[model samples]
Target chain A: MAKPLILVSNDDGITAPGIRTLVEVAKKIGEVVVVAPDGPQSGMGHAITIGNTLRLDRSIAFDDLDIVAYECSGTPADCVKLAKHHVLKDRKPDLVVSGINHGSNSSISVLYSGTMSAAIEAAIEGLPSIGFSLCDYGHEADFSHTREFVEQIIRQALQHRIPENTSLNVNIPKKSSEPIKGIKICRQAHAKWQEEFDERLDPRNRKYYWMTGNFVNFDKGEDTDEWALVNNYVSIVPCQYDMTAHHAIAMLNEGWEF
Target chain B: MAKPLILVSNDDGITAPGIRTLVEVAKKIGEVVVVAPDGPQSGMGHAITIGNTLRLDRSIAFDDLDIVAYECSGTPADCVKLAKHHVLKDRKPDLVVSGINHGSNSSISVLYSGTMSAAIEAAIEGLPSIGFSLCDYGHEADFSHTREFVEQIIRQALQHRIPENTSLNVNIPKKSSEPIKGIKICRQAHAKWQEEFDERLDPRNRKYYWMTGNFVNFDKGEDTDEWALVNNYVSIVPCQYDMTAHHAIAMLNEGWEF
Candidate 1:
């Protein structure tokens, strides 16, 4: 049988250590094709470059490795779109993998994550997809410890594909010396960021403001990603793109007159 | 009664004719406070500015019109966050109105729309919100016939707040001489873009690609937002932010191995 075609991409630039690490893990799964943002699209969410144009070029990042890779000059969503409709137009990928991102996309942050957006775009295209993000946000954050967990999840997902209506959001906790705790199946916790802007001026006497925010985790339950990360365990939350709150649908129907 | 405080924003930059019209209409309904992007953020989805700082400056766009406006250095989602948490820190807005957008965000496009993102952000913040867009993408697109529709919907939404867990995604047909048909409340039609990357060689002899895609509507039901917009009527699709596909949860519970 032909090797399962794995379409890989990320919010970080193609050459970013995160995607480079992702490429390494994906190669073991199947024939890996890397098409990711040419630059970081960290908080890009589901943004597409409609008002502007996108550029794509094959990357040398995978030259030494045995994988095909391309870098796209657009948002994370655009990378998936370009990959499916242009680069891999004639052939459908068996599975799509996004990220191994430098930062976490757990809970409310999921709504603004480019890493998750790439996975959502692929899911919309009917490809089984997953987005992986580590708790660390530093550019040089350590992703070495995440290999075993990443491989286990990827191998399991490839073996038993996730349901059609769902996409996986896997967030690994920062490392500890002890053996990493096993994965926990969880739901997205109700959480949000409390933001504040710091006003400042440039040397040219021009005013500029820097956005700063505090991540306030209001959900105290042990089931949340926040708790799992704090407790030094990997969290696996199945997510979806359909924003329709069907449970609220019936309640909304009764409240408003159409 | 004292005037209602209406917060206005758009994905199109502040100078766009669409937003000017929106400001004009909103002023009649209440005190308008405009917090919009300094540049166009068309497909920004629900993105927020986390890594970078956001800047906001008071604007003189509608100085004589009595609309207090600010040009923001962030995505639509950031604009709403700034407005709610900073700009109007004291008084809660009676209505949060986003976009007299230059283009439609009818179907799956809603998930990638900066216009709708602002509205949904307000919805998540427990405020009444509505996003309005024209089917035309042209800069010079006429909105003369849309005044009454905009006023009607805004009035209805304000008088009777939208259903809980719901915000309105309203799309108006382009300028027409014929009498306008009434509004239809509907669901987002399932749709996606088929991307094409236009590769080119720059002056430096480097290959570049421009992303382009034709909008594809696969939904056939007459009860969809796509159908309503196509039939020359205003479409009001109640959008929500909760992305959990709850129906799948039941099935997952029945079939999954922990």
Candidate 2:
């Protein structure tokens, strides 16, 4: 049997340690192709390059590993589009994986995640996809402990296939002394970033603001991604691109006069 | 009773005619505040400014109407964040509204919409929010006919508060000789953009690509937003930030091995 073709991308750029780790693991499983941002695109969400042109260049980042890779001057979502419609052309990838991101994309953070945006973009294009993230924010975050779990999840995803029109948001706990309990298929927790803007002045005395925020989890449900991550289990939340609140339809129909 | 304070924003920048129409409608209902992007940030989705400092400058655009307005050097989501955290300060807005966008943001376009991003950002911040879009994409789209519907929707939203944690994604059909039938409380149609990148060369002979696509609606459902729009009805889809595919959770739990 031919090896499953896996397309790899990330928000932390093609050269980031996270994508390198993902490439290493992906190559061992199948044919791997990397199409990622040329620079860090954290919190890019589902942004695409519309008002500007995109430049896709061949990257030497994965040359040593004998893997094909391209760096794009666009958002994570744009990289996926370029990969699908430009680079790969007619060659369809069996699975699309994004990240091994150096930070958490659990709960409300998913709305602001470029890592998951890549995965979700692939899903929108009717491909099975998964986005992996580590709960560590360090520049040199330890991905060693996540390798085995990432491999396992990818293998299972390729085998079972992801749920229709959905991408898996898998967040692994950072390297800790304790072993991971197991994997938990969880719902997105109800949470938000309690934002605070730090006001500052530049040399010209012009005021600017830096957005800073703390994650606040309001959901105490054990079946939530936040709960799974807090309990040291790999959290997998099946994320769908359809933003419609189906339950609210009836409410609006009943209450709204128009 | 005191007038309801309405916070207004858009992705088409501070000076766009789409926002001017929104302001014209919103101010009639309540005290209005505008915080929007300094330039076009279309297709920005739910992006936030994390890697850079944000600049918020007072706008003279709304000066004639004596409306308080500021333009931010960031995405639509960033403007909402600045409005909630810094600009508005202790005063909580009774409602938040974004866009009478220059183009359509129905079906899958919602995933790439900065117009909806501002409204969704406000929703995450626990505010009743609605994003309005005109199906016309012309530089000078006819928003004259949309005034009554916009005003009606805003009034209804204020009188009967929007569903919790959900923002309304309302798309008004382009003005035609035939009057709009009515409004439809609809679900987002299953659709996607069939993207084709137009390869081009820069002046320096470097390769660049322009992302272009045609919207394709796969859903034939009468209850969908696409159907409503096609049939000349204003479509209102209640959008939620939670991307979780809850039904797929049970499937993953049963099918996948740990």
Candidate 3:
């Protein structure tokens, strides 16, 4: 049988250590193709390049590993679109995977995650996808401990396939002394970033603000992604792109005069 | 009783006619304040600026009406953050509204909508928020017909309150011969943009691509937002920030081997 074609991408750019680790693992299981941003695109949410021109350049970043790759001058979501519709137009990828991101995208952070945006973009295109992230935020975050679990999750995803019209948001705990307990199927925790702007003056003496925030978790349920990561386990939250609050429809219909 | 403080914003910059219409309606109901992007930020979904500085300047755009307004160098979500954290720190807004956007943001377009992002950002901050959009995509779209409906929706939202943790995504039909029948509480229709990249060459002879697409609606459901808009009714879909597919969680737990 032909190897399953896997398309790999990330928001940390094509040269990030995280994508390299993902590529290393994916190549062992299937045919891998990489299409990612040329530079870091953290906090780029589901942004797409509109009213702007995009450049897609072939890259030699994966030459040593003998893998095909391209660096795109666009957001993570844009890279996925270019990949599916242009680069891989003739052949459909068996699976699309994004990230092994250098940080967490567990709860409300998902709303601002470029890593998951790539995965969600693929999900919107009717492809089975997963976005992986480590809870570590350091520039040189350790991805060694995550390799085995990453492979396991990918294999399981290929075998069972993700639930229809959904993508998996898999967040692994950072390297720790204790072994990971197991994987937990969890819901997104009710959480948010309490933003605090750091007011500063530039050389021109004009005021500018730096966005800083504190993640505040309000959900205490053990079934939440936050709880799973806190307990040293891999958390998988199946996510759908449909933003509609179906339960609220009846409420509005009953109460709203219009 | 004191007047309700209504916070207004948009992705079409501080000076767009769409926002002017919104301000005209909102000020009639309550005290109004505006914080929006300095330039067009359409299609910038949930994005926020990081690794960069933001500029927030007081604007005289609403000076004639004596309304407080500011323009920020950031995305729609960032505008809302600045409004909540810095601009309006001492006082909490009774309501938050974003856009009478120049274009449509129905169905899957919501995933790429900057207009909805501001409203969703406010929802995450625990505020009653609504994003209004006119179906017309013209530079000078006719918002005349939408005035009454926009006002009605805002009044109803202020009176009845939106569902907890949800923001309203309301799309008004473009002005036509026949009047709008009524408003419908609807769900987002299953749809997607089939991207067609228009390859071009820059002045330097470098290949560039323009992202353009045709909106395709696959859902034939009468209860969907697309159906309502097509049938000349204002469509309102309550949108939530949570992307988790709860039903798929149990399925993944039972079917996949962790």
Candidate 4:
């Protein structure tokens, strides 16, 4: 008869509107304990600060929820690491959720996303996890339309359960004329970011460059995350981090002559 | 028949002795082209620079090899992105190999390795790829013993070709008085990093934490990356980026009515 114990995190720092929104939605479903990065970690991917130390300072940002929230001075993966071993050592969370990110983490964006990295870290710990992201990349991107969908998915995940070794990558389309067209189960679109760097010079005239890129979705398939997002539906792509190409194993065996 | 156009890259930067040795070995097997990060990118994982500009500068390090080499001001994955879309646009690499990384990229290290990410990026591009790492992490890590192993694998790979969607995660244990105990096609060991931070006070008296961790390999399976490394053997685990837990899918389907 107890509510699910949910471990919440995000790539957009602890005080970011996105994670605050995530914490609010999660608290309604269960006990929410948040451990997230102290700063924006948008394109951090699966990085862990191994060569540096980590700091987890308690935050009063979400006092309304009466939740235990910590701002970690590390990557999203490091947040999960600290939460599991240090913060929540005695109790195991029923589900771990990350993001409600400020930008899109659909398709190949997932590969470069720290939002999903937090979820992937939990999956590595054998916990059922999900990462959520919005297509809009704004500080105060409206998340009102996503609240219902986010709550429904979390509730269902607790009532049922996701598969092992698999974590859900849920991406919501930006503010739309129509409310979300409902959730669509889809695979990650086969896509990549086409890189284009903008060279800049500081006030002192030292050359520096700002990294920029455009997302190119070559996959026109309807069953992909890109297609789902374009159709005004939140896409739930069950992602795994094992990276074992099972299809190529047999062929490699044939080619590898000892 | 024309030789395979091999794109070589790594995480220890383009100048690390590890990569120089890798390029030396790769030149024998194919038309090697080096595209790696300009500086050390240890533990970078699958990161791609998005909020900043990426620059690609030709390298003089491999001038002797007559190979086209570029040093990208980005992560390992970013290097591959530039190589594919910008540098090698006309010809797709027949094989993409990354790292003779100066450390163990076995088991859980795979998730945090910039080396493996390049290989995974190549696999995503539908090219046969592999990542090679030495068990040694020292700057002057001895690579004499790795030549035979590296050459043999690439030759076999180029001749027969690797399986689709898979890339090799090869690790060579440090050279010893004994010959290698041969290769073990193994799975990633179940492991986790027990992290502890070393906090320090800055000049302004603000506390900052430095990241540190000890790897713990809990999986005692005989056929695992950790076991192979420990037993003085090379570990070759074929890894793919698809993270779907196919077996768990059936279970989730039966349990979760959604």
TM-score of chain A of each: 0.96, 0.99, 0.99, 0.96
- Which candidate would rank higher by TM-score, 3 or 4? 3
Question: Regarding DockQ, does 2 or 4 come out ahead?
Answer: 2
Please give the lDDT score at residue B174 for candidate 3. Answer: 88
TM-score of 1: 0.93
Residue runs of model 1 more than 4 Å from their true location after superposition: A177-179, A220-224, A230-232, A247-258, B203-205, B250-258
Every model's TM-score: 0.93, 0.99, 0.99, 0.90
- How well does candidate 2 match the true structure, expressed as C-alpha RMSD? 0.7
- lDDT for B13 in candidate 1 is 81
Can you write out model 3's per-residue Cα lDDT over A106-131, one digit (the tens) per residue? 99999999999999999999999999
- Estimate how well candidate 3 is docked, as a DockQ score: 0.91
Error of 4 at B132 (Å): 0.5
lDDT of 1 by residue, B95-212 (tens): 9998899988888888899999999888878888999999899868998887888888888778867887578889998877766577877778877777677878889888777777
Regions of model 2 farther than 4 Å from truth: none
Score chain B of candidate 4 by TM-score.
0.96
Model 4 Cα shift for residue A5 (angstroms): 3.2
The candidates' interface RMSDs, in order, read 2.5, 0.7, 0.7, 2.7
Q: What lDDT score is found at residue A240 in candidate 2?
A: 99
Q: List the residue pairs that clash in candidate 2.
A: none
lDDT, each prediction = 0.83, 0.95, 0.95, 0.84
